[model samples]
Target: MPNDTILVVDDSPTEQRVVVSALQAKGYRVITAADGDEAIEKAGREQPRLIVLDVVMPKKNGYQVCRQLKSAPETQHIKVLMLTTKNQDADKFWGMKQGADAYLTKPFASDELITNVTRLY
Candidate 1:
């Protein structure tokens, strides 16, 4: 998808930079949010094509944000990729239940992220 934007939602500055740089390098516009609340606001205001979300955050967590977004008619069309350190099978299942299109564990390669995102779009 040409001109598609991606929202990288993570509290860790390093993780945010990693995802932003990786996606930008692949010619996608990248937006950053420090936590789930910000992510929700940006998801509405920026209307990015995809959201790369982290599970652990100070307020509203990724799962809660994803659920909120999925439930909202205005944001439901946006795809969500859950990227987090929580790699348990149950976590993946819950993420899916919360409406994540894809689930990825931490330490995942940049290429893998790009590949999964590209495949999703």
Candidate 2:
């Protein structure tokens, strides 16, 4: 499972660092994108096992990226975990509607993120 690549997508450099570092510390091969467009491109090219996506981003939001990935036959099998600062119930429901496999809010514990990523495999 550690061999599986995970794409970490966020516009915030700080959030990206935190999640990427956490995942790398767990020995997972992690890649990152600064925005949703890059996220979608990387998801298609890299064929990552999972994508850790942020809700708000430039070019495209997580919901849009998630919807596109889920809709595409080649990418639909990849697990999507919506990790964002949006903690509202409606936001979570929307993420689910977009086909997120799991939804995690910001300020999440490293262990929790690792646990969620591991569970996906």
* Full-model lDDT for every candidate: 0.92, 0.93
Q: Residue-wise lDDT of candidate 2 within 1-121, one digit each (tens)? A: 2238999999999999999999999888989999989999999899999999999999999999999999998899999999999999999999999999999998899999998999985
Runs off by more than 4 Å, candidate 2: 1-3
Q: Against the true structure, what is each candidate's TM-score?
A: 0.96, 0.96
**For model 1, what is the C-alpha lDDT against the true structure?**
0.92
**Cα lDDT for residue 96, candidate 2:** 98
- Summing lDDT over every window of 10 consecutive residues in candidate 1, give the lowest-scoring window: 1-10
Tally clashes: model 2.
0
lDDT of 1 by residue, 20-84 (tens): 98888988888899998999999998888999999999999999999999999889999999999
- Name the regions of candidate 1 deviating beyond 4 angstroms: 1-3
In each prediction, how many residue pairs overlap at the backbone (N, C-alpha, C within less than 3 A)?
0, 0
Which 10-residue span in candidate 2 carries the lowest summed lDDT? 1-10
